[model samples]
Target chain A: MSRWEPDARGRLERAALELYLERGFERTSVAEIAERAGLTERTFFRHYTDKREVLFAGSSALQELLVDTVARAPGPATPMEAVAAALQAAAAVLQERREHARRRHAVITANAELQERELIKLAALAAGLADALRQRGVDDASASLAAEAGIAVFKVAFRRWTEQAGEKDLSEFIGESFAGLKAVTAGT
Target chain B: MSRWEPDARGRLERAALELYLERGFERTSVAEIAERAGLTERTFFRHYTDKREVLFAGSSALQELLVDTVARAPGPATPMEAVAAALQAAAAVLQERREHARRRHAVITANAELQERELIKLAALAAGLADALRQRGVDDASASLAAEAGIAVFKVAFRRWTEQAGEKDLSEFIGESFAGLKAVTAGT
Candidate 1:
C-alpha cells in the first residue's frame, strides 16, 4: 500500500503530535516520529516535509476550501460573507475532530518557534484569501481589507472555539464572530 | 573626538544601507559595515546586536512609541481611535526618516529571508500594540481587533508612502489611509 493516502497523513500527524507532547518538539526527530507511528521516515517525509510542517499540513486544504468557496459564493455575498462561508466549511471539516485539534493546539502554543511558523502560515493564508477576493473583482484595497477582517474573525472565533469545552459549535461561534467583526467595523 | 556620540547610530545605519545596496546583505559583513561608517566593529555591536538587525533596528522604538501612545490615550477615544493615534505617532517618527526608510524597504523586499524576518517583527509589533490597548482597559476582542485594524492601515499606507518619489510626504499619506479605512468601515 502506498503511503500517499489521506489517512496516512492523519496518522503521521497524530503520531508526531503524541511524541512532541511527550518529549517536546526540539528533541523529537522525524525518525522517532515515524517509528512511533509504525511508519518509515520516508513515509513521514512523503506526508510532511518537516516536523514543523505537521502542524500546518492541513493549511493547504483549508486554503483550497476557502478559495473555492469564495469563488462560488452566491450573488450579493460580500467578501466577508464569502470568507465566512469558507470558515463554516472548514468548521465542518475540523469541528468533528475536537480532541485531536485541542491536543495539537496545546503543543503549538507551548513552542515559540512553532508559533512563529504558524503566524507566517496564517499571514500567507490571509494574503491568499485576499487574492481570491480580488479575483472576484473586489478591487485591491477592499479585497485586502475584507480578507484581513475575515482572518481576524477566524482567529478570534477559532480561539474561542478551542478554549470553550462545549459552549458552542465551531460554525456557530464563527457566525457570531463574523457578525461581531461586521458590528465592530460598522461602528466606525 | 569619539564615534560614541549621539549621532553615531545614524552614521552606522547610513553606512550599512549604502553597503547593502552596493554589495547586498550577504556580501556585506559587520566589520565592513562598521569600517564604512568610520567606526570599529565594536562600536557597531554596541548599537545593534547583529548585521541583519541594522535593517530592522527601528522596530523597538516604534513599538515603544505605539505602546506609550495607546496607554496614555485620552479615555473617551474609541478603541479604533486609540489605535489610530498610536499609528499616527509612528507615522511621525517614520516619516522623519523617509529616505532611510525607503532604502531599507527596498532592500528587505528584495530578500526572502529578510522578508520573513520582517513579517515576524511586524507580527510581534502588532501583538505588542494589541497588548498595550488591552492594558488601557479595552476588552480583549476589541483591543485585538483595533490593533489588527491599525496594522492593516499601516501596511497599506506604508507601502504607498515608500513608493512615492516626487517629493511626497509619508505622514500625509498615513493620514489619508486612516481616513479611507474609517470610511470603508463606516456606515455599514
Candidate 2:
C-alpha cells in the first residue's frame, strides 16, 4: 500500500457515503470504507479520527466560512443583514456541491445519531455567528437572536434546496427563506 | 421496597439531578439515584427509561402546551403571534419550577451528550409547533420558519431567564426576546 494516495480524502468521503447509503450507517465499518475507497484503514485513520468524523469533516470549515463572512460584512450592515450575507455565502459554496450536499443530507436524515451531530454543528455555527456579531458591536441579546434566526433560515432553505430539482440556486432559497422569516416574524 | 411509593417520581428526579450534579451524568446510575431517593431501581425504571430521561421528562408536556396554545390562538392571530403565545404559556409553566429548571440546565450544560439531547428535544418541539401552525392554515414554509424562529427566541430567552436572578418572570423574558427577535429580523 503506497502512502502517497491521490485524492484520498475525497475518495474516502465518496466511499463512506456510498457505503452509508447501501448499508445503514450503523452497519458500515471504517475498514469497509477504506477498502471501498481502494485505500488502507491506516490511510482512513490519517484522514478522519473515526467513521462518524467522515460525515462531519466539513463542519468546522463551514463554521469558519460563516464566521468569516459575518466578520467581513460592511461596517454599516445590520446584524440580520450580516447574517443573511453569511448564509448566502454558504449557500453559494453549497451550490457548487449540490449532489454531495444532497447525499450527505440523506445520510444524516436516515440516522438519529447523525441528526444529533448535525444539530450540534448547526448550534455551533449559530454561536460562531453570534460571536462575530458581538465583535461587530451588536448587543448580546440581538446578536444571539439574529444568528439563531439566520441559522433557522439556513436550515429551512437548505432542506428545501436539497429536496427540490436542480432548477434554482441554494442562494435564492436562502434569500427567499430569509424573506419568509422576516414576514413571519413581522406577523404578516 | 413497596410498589406504592409516594412522590416517587419527584423524589427520583431530585435524586437524579443531585447525583448528576455531584457525580456527573456519566457517573450517575439508576440504582444510586433510586437509593438516594429512598426508592428501588424498579420504581426508578417505572418512572423513567433511563437516568437521562429524568431531565427531559417534561419535554413532551411542554411540547403539548406549545402545540395546544398555537392551535387555540385567536383566528386572526399571525403565525409568529401564535408561536409567541405558545412560548409564553411554556414560560408560565417553567416559572413555577425555576430552581429545578436552573439545576437541570446546569447539569445539561455540563455534559455534551445531554446538550445534544436538549437540542434534539428543541428540534422536536419546533417540528410540533410547525405542525400546529400548519393545522391552523399557515403555509408549510411559513409554519416551519415561524416555529424555528419561535424556538430560537425561546432558547435565548430561557437561557437568559435561567442565568439571571428570579427578579423577572420567564414570560416577561419571553415577551422581550420575541420583541428582540422581531427587531433584529426587521433589521432595526
Candidate 3:
C-alpha cells in the first residue's frame, strides 16, 4: 500500500469533495479525483477503496480520540463530565478543519447514502466510547447512556457550529449542547 | 394501493421474518415471502416497495404514536416528561408484540442494511418527536435533546427487555432506562 505517500490521502479527499460538489457524488469518479490531486490512481486506491470513503476517512480517528479521552478521564469524575471532556477533546481536533467539515457535512446531507454512512459512523463511535467507559469501571447501562448522550450532544452541536455565521468555537458549542442535554433531561 | 387488504400486511411481516431467519436476510426473496404469506407477488407490491420495507413497516405507526403522545402531553410537562410519557404510551403498543419485536430486532441486528434502516427509522422518530415538542412550546434545542435522549433510552431499554429471560413489561424497562439516563448525566 502507498499509505506512506505523505498527505496523498488528504489531497485525494480535498479533490474528491470539490469534484463531488461540482458534479454530484454519483457523477464524480475516483480517476478524476486522483488526477485532480496530482496522484496516481494506484496511490488513491492505496489510500481509499472508493470515493465515498474520502468523506468518511476521519471516522476512525475521531472514534479513537473519543475513546482515549473517555478512558483517561479522572476516576472521580461523573460519567457526563467524562463524556463532556471527551467531546471537547474531539472538538479541538475538528476546530482546525471547520471549513472542511462544513463542506463535508453539506455533501453528506445532500446524499442519502452518505447520510446513512454518517449515522453508522456515529453509532460506531458511540459504541466505542461506551466500551471505553466500561473499561474504566463504569457499569454497562451507565456507560451506554453517557456515551449515547455525548454523541447526541456532539451531533447537535456540530450541526450548530457548521451552520452558525459567527466566530464561536466548536468546543463552546459542544459545552453548551451538553448543558442543553442536561437541562432537557432535568425533571420538573 | 391495497392498503385495506385484511391481515395481508401482518401475514407478510410474519412470513418475512420467518424466511429471513431461516434463509438469512440476504438470501430471502420477495417471491418466497409472498408465497409463504399465502399471497401473490401483486399483493406484496401493493403493500411494500421491497423486502426491506417489511422490517421497517412499523416505523410510521411508531412515529405517529410518539408525535401524538408528545403533542397531547400535559400542558406544563417538561420536555423530558413529555418524551417519557410518549415512550410509555408507545411501549404499550409494543408490549403485546414482545415475541415479534424480539424476532424483528434479531433480524435487524443480524444485517448491516437492516441496522442502517433501523437507525434511519430512529432518526425519523426523533425528528417527529422533536417537532411535536416544538408544537407544545418547547424550545428548539430542548426539543431536539429530549427527543434524542428519549430514543436513546428506548433503544437501550428495548435491548434489555429483549435480552432478559423474565417477563418484565416494556414500559417498566423504559421507565428504568429513563431514570438510568438521568443517573448517567447527573454531574458532581
Candidate 4:
C-alpha cells in the first residue's frame, strides 16, 4: 500500500536516518519522517512510538537477542566463554545489517543525548547477560564481572567492525578483541 | 563572601535534594532550585551547571582523584592492586560526603535519563583510568580490562558500603570486593 514498497520497518528506518542525519535529531519530527518514507503518519506511529524511538527501534530486540543467546549457551562454558559465545551469536545476527548498523552508529555518535541513551541500553544488555549467567548458577559478582568484560569486548569489537570496509566480519573482530583483552589482562 | 553566610554549594545541594525528592527531576528547574537554596540564579550557576548537575558535582573531582591515585601508585603493583589502591583513595575522598552520595544515588535511580548520564560518566571515568594505566606502561587492552575490572570491584564494594547501617567503612568494603573479584578471576 505504501509508495516506497520496501518492507514497512526498513522503509521507516531508512526514512528516519535520512531525516535525522539531515536535520539534527531534536529537530526531526515523526510526520516529516512519515512523509519522507511515503508512508502515513499512522503507519509511522505503528512502526515507532516517537522520533526518539526511531533512533532505537532495534535496541529492545538486540537486548532480547543477547539475553536469549546467553540463556541458550552450552553448559560447561566459563562465564567469560559463555558471554563470548553470545556476542558471537550477536555478530552473526548483525552481519547482515551492516548498512543499518553504520547508519545507527553515525546518528548515535553525532548526538550526545542519543549516545547516552545508547550507553544505557548497552548497560541494560550487560545487566541482562549477568542475570542470565547468574541463573546458570554463577555467583553474582562473577556474573557481573564476566558480563562487564563481555561488554568491554563487544564495544571494542563493534568499534573495530564499523571502522572498516569490505566483507569484514564482526564475529572475527569480536573473537580477536576477546583474545586481545585476555592477553592484555593475562599473566599479569 | 557567598550568600547563606558559608558553603553556598553545600546549601544548594541540600536544597536541590529536598526539591527533587518532593517534586521529581523533570519538574524541577534552576530558578526553583536556587530559590529553595535561598540564592539567586547567578549564584546557582556559579556553583553548578544546572538542576541535574547539582547531584553530580563530585564525579569529575572523583575521577581526577582516582586518576592521580593510579598515576602516583608505585609501578611494581599489579593492575588490580593499583586499582584497589585508587578505590581505597576514593573511599577517603568520598566518605565525608556519604549523605550527598546517598541523595545523588536516589535522584539518579529515580530517573532513567539520569541513569543514562551516570552510566556514560562512569564509562568515561573508566576510560580515563584505563588511559592512566596505559600511561603507566600497561598494555592497551589489558589496561582497559583491568580498569573495567576495577570498576566492577568498586561497584560491588560501593553497593555493600551504601547498604550497611552507619559505622560501616567503605574502604573495607572496597578491599573485600577487590579481593573477591581477584579471587574469582584469579586463575582465569
lDDT of 1 by residue, A140-174 (tens): 77677767666777777787888886857888877
Q: Higher DockQ: candidate 2 or 3?
A: 2
Interface RMSD of each: 2.9, 1.6, 1.4, 3.2
DockQ of each: 0.41, 0.76, 0.71, 0.39
Decoy 4 TM-score against native: 0.83
Better of 2 and 3 by lDDT: 2
What are the runs in model 3 whose C-alpha is more than 4 Å off?
A1-6, B1-6
CAPRI-style quality class for the chain A–B interface of candidate 4: acceptable
Which ten-residue region of model 2 chain B has the weakest summed lDDT?
B1-10
Candidate 2: pairs in clash = none
In order of DockQ, best first, we have 2, 3, 1, 4
Rate residue B188 of model 2 by lDDT: 35
* Model 3 per-residue lDDT tens digits across residues B86-117: 89988999999988999998998899888988
**Cα DockQ of the candidate 3 complex:** 0.71
Q: Best-fitting candidate, measured by DockQ?
A: 2
lDDT of 3 by residue, A31-109 (tens): 9999999989999888888889899988889888888898888889888888888899989989999889988998998
Q: Please give the distance, in angstroms, between residue A115's alpha carbon in candidate 2 and its true position after superposition.
A: 1.0
User: Where does model 1 exceed 4 Å of error?
Assistant: A1-6, B1-6, B165-168, B179-188
Query: Can you tell me the CAPRI class of model 2?
Result: medium
* lDDT (Cα, tens digit) per residue for candidate 2, span A79-188: 99999988888888889998999999999999998998899899999999999999999999999999999999999999999899768999989889989998998883
